[model samples]
Target: MIYKVFYQPKPEQVPVRENTESFYVEASSEREARKILADKNISIEFVQQISGVFLEYEKQNLNFKVEQG
Candidate 1:
């Protein structure tokens, strides 16, 4: 199956929009599809398998924070 991944890398840049990209990857299964892109440091927003429904995964939380005591 071919999965189209829409993602924006971490530490996203600037006020301009266009932060995400659509990439097509061929894989055997949904899990495999995710693994393929994971290697590239791409933060997935949505991934829809070509000719099929979107694949779901655990949402990632990567917020930066600072604490003072």
Candidate 2:
């Protein structure tokens, strides 16, 4: 499955609208996805599972790229 992970790049910084960034990751589950990113120095905001129409729509975006853990 694919998950859209929203996070702040700096661990010490609080997440703000403009400062937050997102990426797509392939993982078996949300917990697994979090675990995969555990070592990265980033503050996670949310891990959302996306599929169907939502996934298709995201794929159309120019910035859409899935990161491999």
Clashes of each: 0, 0
Candidate 2 residue lDDT tens string, 8-30 = 89879867979989999999999
**Which has the greatest lDDT?**
2
For candidate 1, the clash count comes to: 0
Residue-by-residue lDDT tens digits, candidate 1, 1-69: 556667777635532247775666677776877776666765678777655323222112132121111
RMSD of each: 14.5, 0.9
Error of 2 at 57 (Å): 0.5
Q: How close is candidate 2 to the true structure, as a TM-score?
A: 0.93
Residue ranges of candidate 2 with Cα displaced over 4 Å: none
lDDT for model 2: 0.93
Cα displacement (angstroms), candidate 2, residue 52, comes to 0.4
